[model samples]
Target: MRDLQLYASEAQRYPPESVRNHMISNSIVPIARQFNEDMDALRGLLPTQTPCPLPARMAFVRNKKSLEGIIQRLDHRKIAATNIIARYNNGFHLLYLLANLSRLDGFRLHCNILSAADGIKALSVSQDALSQTLSRRHDALEAELQGQKAEVVEGLQYQGSKTSLALASLESRVHSQQQSLDELSSRMSSAVASPDVLGRMVRAELRQQLEPLLHRFADVSLLIDQIALGVSKKASEHSDFKTGGSGAIHGLSNPGSERRVIYTWVTTYRVRGSQDGYFRFRFVFMPRSWLCSTGISLVFSSGPDEFGHYSICPSILPIQIIPYSSPVWDIFERDDAFAVRQLVEHGKLGLRALTEFGQNLLRHAVHDNLPNICRYLLRDSGYGTLFLDDADMSMEIPWSLIADRSVEDDIESTREILQLLRAYSDSGDDSGNQSEWGWNNIFCSPCLSFEQKKSYGHLFLEFGATLRLFSWIRNDDMELNKSLLNFYLDTGGDPNQFAKTGIPPLLFALLLLSRGDIEPDISLVTILISAGADIYYIHDPDNDPDTARTTTDWAFALEVEDLWEAALEECGLDIASVYAESDRRLQDHRRLRGATRSGVDVESITEPGPSSELRRRAGQAGRRCEEGWIAE
Candidate 1:
């Protein structure tokens, strides 16, 4: 009741618009009904005495019928009507006097009389009439000017000026426009006749030759778009793209230096036409973040007539135009060009309105293009090729596609393993003929490309190690594979060089063991153990741990727990017995070295002796020494 009294006092003192009367209700239905009733009563009392009541009032008045042919119309709502009534009631007498004076002014305007009311009213009436007439004339002039069109010329068109001296303005603006055009023309000419003309020509020829590549590129783009849409939808659902304060993950606008990447045109050209030909421009994306590697290149062709619309040229054709002699055409051919074409031509339905469509396309290309590219290198190219191409792709491609992915690093590591294999194979003269080489010699001679040798050595070692791991597990040649595993460990191959940032060889072996691909070869286990590979490195169940148990045999039978232990205990061949077997072979090596030093009978000592217990141990020790391993 006190609240009601205060509200009533407020409403009487202030216009309805100034006072917001609120009510509390027992229930929703009753409250709504009470509100309607109160609003109706307030609305009905508005026009009587409230029109000009307060300094601030909420009244909707439209000029329905003013002195000039204007009309005042007012909204007949409760608050608005009440406000109008209160304002009018407060100024009723003053308004009446003004109305009388207005009538005298109207009479004076026609009669030219000079009474007190007439003089003031006449001035107001004349000023209003003059202002209205001038405003109407200005509107008409503006409409006429807008309707006028400049005459079309056969050769040139002039830009009109706001001032009366339009011709002078046109001449001045034309000089600036011509200057810009001339500069651009000079650049285009210089680009055409560049010292690197061969490169430019090759790119052009490539565009024509690899017309199919462009199509494939388009197809790849579509696939990327589809994939991007999926990822974006998920990311967006999980995140926001709104622009806000810096580093606020919600908004994606400007993605800033961290998330946003800039793209530059790779090549630009103009195709001559009857009028103005199409301008073809190609953009290559480079992500700012050091983390992003794979970039994508896009071609956009537009015409003067098209204005904002541009024809997107998908992948350019595959051509060998670069300075490098060996072309990558074979690799691109092996990629799913047909599938890419299908994606661009027929797939990805509901993603037309996105401006970041190109970004999505690049993403799809990374997923689709990168794997295939890796496979080609693995099969036909060397590890070195992988490094060069991977670097190029990363540097040149758009990051938006693979911004969230780390698979490229794994691929790079794989390349490193392949390189290591080459090094291992090259270290020997047999050329992978022995059981030690594994069946196909995945890292053998075919990989010794001239270009590959020039590549980074560290990367090569990584590839060699990874490949060695894969081969070891795949062939399950445990006894024979021990040397390879030991080489990787002893050489200090990075233990954390895999996608999981851990040694992959161990995992591959363990996984193979788990799947029963091949029983952990006793010999392999022994070598790994001897080299200090953590056999007891138990893996968390959540994380895959592939480790084996092995102990080193440093010149002593007891120290070697793997192969040597089995031979000594299970085979009943004690250390003394093996030592006897290896004696003759050890003597032969000593004889050969002596003869070679003395420049006599080197060939005669080359023949090894028949197997003996002492000779076996000596031979084993000699082999270890040859491999740079000290037998303690």
Candidate 2:
């Protein structure tokens, strides 16, 4: 039973399915049962043999033949014993196989338990690391939320402060405006209380201010009227003197006795004809008053035997010579002549008027056959100084034409007529008190002192023709004057020659431009420039220092330079280049003049002098004349 218990314990150590059930059934189980049965039988037999002795059992196999039979039996018995032992060994081998299988199953179960334990330990470590990472993330999110909340709080505070400031400013402005409105209302109520008193006060103040001004204005007007009347009386006296009437007549009771009266015939040639057909002249003359209508008269004598005198008025001469509808007057009115024929025709009309008047006188002389009258008018009448009283008639007479027709037989009469006509035309009395003859007196008058004559002579020799041409320019004869200027320049007249007025021709032309009397003629300026007139030349300050003083007061140089630059541009010259070129040319010319005068005889040109200082002065005057210093 004990052995069976041990085997059952061993089998329980492993599951039944772990050990092979076939092995147990075929070998281990059967062997275990047979061994148990054999043990029981041996126990019964051993008790029976235990009563017998060991020598007595051996005596049964003693004799040889008997021994052989016995041996065979014994061999058979040995064979049987060996077979039992082999069967036991085979059963033991089955037990050993089942034990090994049980052990293998136990080892596999232990390995599986170790693997499950390792897996559980790794899962716990991973869980610990994940929890730490989640804790760190939670802390970071809390910090970020705190920062955002603080920034929101700061923004709200800033917005609240700005709103407070804006509201305060608006409230203050509203208060100021309300105060202004209240003050304006109070002032308006006060103004509305006394409207009539305010109006009267305003009106009284205005009248009080204006009364003295009105009285002063009336007094000034009365004074001005009295002054105007006196000025008119003086102006009339001056006009009488200018027009060759006797202003001394106002101081004289018998004004007609002061007049110097004479009579002459218009022609001296006698013709074979009847008694009296001649023009008689009468003259009562003042200085330069021969052409005055109040000082002269004309009469026609036409009768066979009786001397009948008919008066002719001098004022009716121009009306008869040029009727209102005449084309000659039209030429004067239009003031523009396109062709030479037009000018010639106009001049012919003037000549025709003088010629016809002379012819009429000649006819009356021939018809009267007045030999005694011709002699009395030419030699005995003493009327040679008398002139025609009409100024317009004298101007239109063409005195040169009349001189050309003078006869040797009537030479004295022709000379007397020409002298009177020239004196009448050239004197200032013909135009007005103001002389229209510019710079002519400097050359024509012979009564000047020697020094004055010398100074004027130089100017006249240098610029006489040009000055006369300028006179034509004043008469609206620009084309003729331009031609005359060109001719004078062609004949070696210096365009830069200064007049006695101490003004250059170009400066005079510029003065005319300033006066708006002439258009800016580029051609005329170019001609002057080409004839050696300096574009950049300024008048010497020593000659006319007043010009500089006036320029400073008026700032005239800027205006002059602007006009000059504009004129140069109109003439198609670049102003800067022209100015530079002109300065260069002037320098060259000055150098040339200085070099040429180095060996000149200074003493030969000066007057005979008593002292060194006078000689020096005369030398300086000669040099100044050579340098063209015209005296004003």
Candidate 3:
């Protein structure tokens, strides 16, 4: 039984699924059967099927003591039964404990195996994913490095190309420079080799050419000196001839034996719109055989078809003779008186009208054969100097304006005079040698020097007063404004006359802008410009002062003022607010003047006309005059 028990315990310890039922039957069934049999014995009971009478069974169990003993035995049997129950209960408890322990150990082993398998699978998957990720990253990095290397290579190639181009250009330039240097060296060598001989030849030629010119110049000088000396002697002897000429005819030659008239020419033209007429007198030459006397001749033609008849008047005269009296002189005096009166009664408006009238009068004079006469004289006599008797009145006339009839005419006359003088002075030049002379030399050579010339004794006061009037204008002495106006009106002083510095009255007014004491007078500017002072005249930059070097009107105004406010009140821009405003204002002023001359009411026009429009109108007017649509 012990062995069986040990075997059973071992079987329980190593219970395989195949023998589980056998182990349970062998270990527990017998113990359960013994416990059941013991309980039955303690009960001492039989089934009803057993054949026994009830009375017989009662008799056998009679007597209290005997019954008590039987009871005791039954009691023992119950105790034994209780013992067996206790053992069975304890054994069942032990078996249950062992089975639960076995189940718990199996469960632990299964859990450990599952956990390790899962762990291994997870590690393997993670490693594979990690390797794929690393490979992809490495490929991307390698591609990026390769792209970078290609870009670097391309950049290096581009830089190399640029460097090569630059080197080629440098080499080409160096070669060109070397060639230029070689050529320059060759030229320098040749120049140095023959410089002395070339210089000697040039000097010799120049000296040979200059010798004849010098000799001729000396002869001309001597002739001029002799003429001047003879004139001075005559002037000294006949002092009355110099002082007596208030009218044009004051120095008329008295018929005398000492003077003989050579050739004379005269003509008369009736003044348009007046009863007056201009009488012209011309003398060709005077002989020294007439004891230094001069001849005067008067001639007139009855018609253009008739031969002109001439009359000679022998006269003792100075070299400079006063002009003869004529209806033209009388007209000039009347014009002067009218101008003075109008200026006193009115103002600059009157002066402007007078200026226009004077210009008309000059145009008429020039048109009526005065230019022709002057041209003939200049061409016939190779001397530019001519003396008019009425010096005071003649000075008042704008002779320059008359002389500037047309640019072509003036140029032709100037050329002819120059050629004639050159021919006379250098008659021996058969070599056709050409030499140039300045305008000043040709025109001023025969005229007396400014210092050597005598003043108009009777006209000195008037000239001084006129000069004083100019001074007053310069000094802004408005107190004598009326006197100055009167003087200007009477004398018709040239407002556009150039000063020694070549500045005109308009430019002088501009210069006055810098003077703090004098207000910039727009009215003065207007007057000067209306009187024909050229506002747009540009001074030679080389000769002009630094301030006057500014060429435009607006630029000049800007230089005069540092601020706009100051510029507003000064710089002759009273009607202007800004630089552009001043420019428009000046343009308007010029347009207005030009339009008025064309009989247009410029104030009624809103738009300022262009400068070319005015010039066109002037050209049209000139054409009309030439066509005799309007009388000169």
Give per-candidate clash totals: 74, 0, 7
TM-score per candidate, in order? 0.21, 0.24, 0.21
lDDT of 2: 0.38
- lDDT winner between candidates 2 and 3: 2
Instruction: After superposing candidate 2 on the true structure, give the runs of residues whose Cα lies further than 4 Å from its correct spot.
Output: 1-481, 487-494, 497-500, 515-519, 540-563, 566-632
- The parts of candidate 1 lying over 4 Å away from their true place are 1-285, 288-339, 342-558, 561-563, 568-574, 580-598, 601-609, 612-632
Off by over 4 Å in 3: 1-268, 271-281, 284-291, 301-508, 511-578, 584-632
Candidate 3 structure quality by residue, lDDT tens digits, 262-325:
5454545464488866555544444332133232222333322113443344332333121223
**In candidate 2, what are the lDDT values of residues 1-632, reduced to their tens digit?**
34553664566577766655422333344444443454343233221332234342333223224434433443443344334434554446544544454355336434533443444455456667878999999999999999999999999999999998987876565444433432111112122344445445534543333333334235423333433343333332323211111122212222233443343434321224745344334222221122222222343323121233334444222212333344544443332223213444555532213111223221222222333332333234343122222222222222223322212223334334434334434322222212223233332233443344234334333322222323322423355445545644544445656654555566655554454455544455545544545454535446332332221112144245556656556544566565554444334335444221235544321121122111111233334434644222
lDDT for each residue of candidate 1 in 516-624, tens digit (9 for 90 to 100): 4455344443343333232222222233212211111122323233444453344333645445434433344344432322455444322222321211122333345
Using TM-score as the measure, the top candidate is 2
Where's the lowest-lDDT run of ten residues in candidate 3?
241-250
How well does candidate 1 match the true structure, expressed as C-alpha RMSD? 29.0
